[model samples]
Target: MSIFISKEAKDKAQGYWFGLLIPLLAGWGVSTFSMAALMSRDGPVSEMTYVDYFFITGWISGGLVVHPLCAWWVLLRAKIVGNAPCIKGAYMSIKLYILWIFFLLSMTIISFIWGE
Candidate 1:
């Protein structure tokens, strides 16, 4: 179980990691430049562009709920929910990602203009 499980797990991780890399990168880039980022003080996080995504979005929502829940949803769809549901869910997940980037932007702008 050890080696097999390890390899399979790595494969699965790589699959998801690469699968979402573009969306992640796009989201990060847009979020960094779009509006007043939620947690941005006066500069980019860590002076690294990608780190901005990893910190604000990752910590605020991704770490708290999005990443784990999406992983579980993906796994549940794959293992238990069957193909159709998985595909449908995956499509919606991508759409949700698009809308979410917009939502974050709107929220940041509103907060900046309106306060609190």
Candidate 2:
């Protein structure tokens, strides 16, 4: 094994990390925080107004849509810069996206069960 890493390898690694981190943070992190904040409000879930419901739906659904797009964009940019291919980044993004979905679903269920 070579001790030194090539620039291309480094770029690809960076691209992969960015693809994972950006969406995970921007999409999952923000949505999770927002949802938690909304849920943690003074009133019960049943007391949430239309606007609150709209925002909750928007945040979760929007993250589902937008974050993957963000990942794709990042991967595309990396490819354009001759760093990495889209495959690995895309795979990572999809995995994270799935996990995010499950998390949101579980959170929603838990909130509904005990959020009185």
Point to the candidate with the largest TM-score.
Answer: 2
Q: Which 10 consecutive residues of model 1 have the lowest summed lDDT?
A: 18-27
Report the Cα lDDT for candidate 1.
0.54
What TM-score would every model get versus the actual structure?
Answer: 0.32, 0.60
Model 1 pairs whose backbones collide: none
CA RMSD of all predictions: 10.9, 5.6
lDDT of 1 by residue, 11-77 (tens): 6555555434433444445445533554555764466566555555544554235543554456465
The runs of at least 3 residues in candidate 1 whose Cα sits more than 4 Å from the true structure, single-residue gaps closed, are 1-58, 61-82
lDDT of 2 by residue, 1-116 (tens): 75438977766676667767776667776578667767777887777888787668857755887688777777777667665544477668878788878998999999999974
TM-score of predicted structure 1 = 0.32
